[model samples]
Target: KFTITDGRIARIETDTSAGDAVRLGPALPGLANVQSHAFQGAMAGLAETRGDTGDTFWTWREVMYRFLERLDPDMAQAIAAMGQVEMLEGGFTRVGEFH
Candidate 1:
């Protein structure tokens, strides 16, 4: 059995009586995403190809800049929401969004 205090697990012990115990399904500890550029999620798969010379970080930044140029507040909000949903689905309970 487990006891929760202040939204956290405080104690765990073996219980002989199961009559009043609550049954919960499988559970796993959540993960934390320390750095997240959630707005960039909208650019997924948009700059994955190599250029004629070679693929470089500058080229990626250019692509990202172009995307940002056309992104409005509504689009940014949608992208951020999508990213947060993806994070939660991947077991991230805490996020430190950079943008």
Candidate 2:
């Protein structure tokens, strides 16, 4: 465990002995969710249903753009908060929201 006091790291301790616990498992760094349209989480499965004759990235983008038109600052913040929460729950510590 480690504790930060004021502007510096103060105390550090370990529960087990030095060689008792070797690094065996994969060391996974926190994921950076780069390039996520924050508001799309709400609409993830919405377009998977029946749509026009052919549904492609362009078609999905059109739907996403329509959703974007409805969001203001507050809505955007709310969406970002929700997205961040979900990302953290899924082991992602940082997210790079792409507009």
Candidate 3:
């Protein structure tokens, strides 16, 4: 259980007697998404084509750099917001963004 005050977290307490305290559906708050490259999510699955050379990690990294170069502030913010919303919808309460 958690307590909120003044729009901030105030306390958390565990009690065995409060059966309703336990969430049974779509529960969040305990979930975490570590190693999250949120901006990369926008470019997911776009680095799988074989070029003159094979799709090596080096090639992928170059592609990623190109992608980054094309990112404007608004696009970056929109993509990041999208990632955060997806994480929250997927039940993640915390995330570590690597951008």
TM-score of each: 0.73, 0.65, 0.68
User: What local distance difference test score does each model get?
Assistant: 0.85, 0.75, 0.80
* Decoy 1 TM-score against native: 0.73
How many pairs of residues collide in each model? 0, 0, 0
Positional deviation of residue 71's Cα in model 1 after best superposition, in angstroms: 0.6
Q: Count clashing pairs, candidate 2.
A: 0
Per-residue lDDT over 1-99 for candidate 1, one digit per residue giving the tens place of the 0 to 100 score: 766789667877785666676888665678999998988888988987776677689889989999999989898889989999999988899999986
The TM-score, computed over Cα atoms with residue i paired to residue i, of candidate 2 is 0.65
Cα lDDT of model 2 by residue, 1-99, tens digit: 444468343765677455544544554557788886767887788687768778888988898888788889898888889988989889787788887
lDDT of 2: 0.75
Residue 71, candidate 3: Cα error in Å is 0.7
**Pairs clashing in candidate 3?**
none
Ranked by TM-score, the better of candidates 2 and 3 is 3
Relative to the true structure, candidate 1 has a C-alpha RMSD (angstroms) of: 4.0
The Cα error of candidate 3 at residue 30, in Å, is 2.3
lDDT for model 1: 0.85
Candidate 1 lDDT for residue 99: 65
- Give the Å error, residue 94, model 2: 1.8
Best-performing candidate as measured by TM-score: 1
| lDDT-based ranking | 1, 3, 2
